[model samples]
Target: MKKKNDENVLATNRQARHNYEIEDTIEAGIELQGTEIKSVRAGKINLRDGYVSIKNGQANLSNVHISEYKQGNIYNHDPLRVRRLLLHKKELKRLAKEVDQDGMTIVPLKVYLKHGFAKVLIGVAKGKKNYDKRESLKQKELKRELQRNFKLNQF
Candidate 1:
């Protein structure tokens, strides 16, 4: 059987890192139904391709897929429904300000179980240009080569 941690991390948006340079992060609580919460606990959630949008001065998450519970039928929540995120008014204002800047966005980084409750790690990020992404890739390759050379010399 897998470890407990395997069932804890429901999903992570890997594209968030590659597509944007994460500037800051904050944890937020999400409003979820009973079945949705159960589905998340069973590790049936996807954060990739999910995004946050502000409507009427409130933040809402969209495109997040939380699989239906095995036993849930009529009570199942929509897989891609927009869910509200719990944030302080001041924090929401700050996020709204940041999002108003060009190329900046609010994205969910990961969803995980915290003390029996589901929590989301949201990040304020700025989209990177093609050249910026290339530079990051180059830096990664250089780091890998340096590590390889050091290991070979040690052996």
Candidate 2:
């Protein structure tokens, strides 16, 4: 059996890094039903294609899939429902302005339990062009090669 970490990370969207250039991040509380939280703790959550949107001064999380709990039976929540994100009004306004003016969008980076409350780490990010993605891959390869060479020299 796999051991769960004390840190309690439910899901992480590593692909967000490859697809977007994140500029700012904030922690926001997510509204979840009992079964939804159960599914999250069991690590059946996916944020790979998830995104955030602000409508009517409220932030909403979309496309973040939390699989139904096996034991939930009739109490299971929808796997792909749009969940409400709780944030300060001031923060919402600021995010809305930046998104409108900068053409950036919000994306969930990771979800975890904090102080027994489910929190999501979200970022304001601009989508990367194809060329930008390729360049990032090239830079990552260079960094890996440098690290490998340094380890060899230390031997």
Candidate 3:
């Protein structure tokens, strides 16, 4: 049986939008142990403080917390271990080049199950300045107010 979208989930980092401007996205496979996979299936993962770093020419996800499976007494995975992200050589090289540029970063946007396999959505982003963030907030508020006025006029 398949789990519902809302169920069998762990955690999500919603703060990515507030901190950075996402430029592009890529899906990468997460290398997991059997116990860790089970724990992820049960929705015991956290990607809030998670980040991807290049080490020895490879990408590794750090600070991503995958909680220990309750049923696995002896073979449970560590909750805060670094997990490898699978990507093609070409993609890896591209990401590496982009990250080498100033203000560019790699952020894991979301972790979800696809076709019974766990997948992560990673975004290449640039940090937004304080003025940029404030402008975005102002635009959002103006849009909301316009919507509200439109709805009131309709009624």
Best by lDDT: 2
Please give, for residues 1-155, the per-residue lDDT of candidate 3 as tens digits. 65575553445678888789999999888889999988887778888888999878788999999999999999888899999999999999999999999999998988878778788889999999999999989998999999999999998
TM-score versus the correct structure, for each prediction: 0.90, 0.94, 0.88
Model 1 compared with the native: what TM-score?
A: 0.90
- TM-score, model 3 to reference: 0.88
lDDT (tens digit, per residue) of candidate 2 on 72-138: 9898899999999999999999999989966599999999988788999999999999999999999
Q: Which one wins by TM-score: 2 or 3?
A: 2
Residue 124 shift from truth in candidate 1, angstroms: 0.8
> Model 1: which residue pairs collide?
none
In order of TM-score, best first, we have 2, 1, 3
- Give the Cα-based TM-score of candidate 2 against the true structure: 0.94
- Candidate 3: residue 65 Cα off by (Å): 1.1
**Cα lDDT, all candidates:** 0.90, 0.93, 0.87
- Local accuracy of candidate 1 as per-residue lDDT tens digits, 25-116: 98888999999998988889999888898778788999999998999989888899999998898889999998999988999999988788
Residue 87's C-alpha lDDT in candidate 2?
A: 100
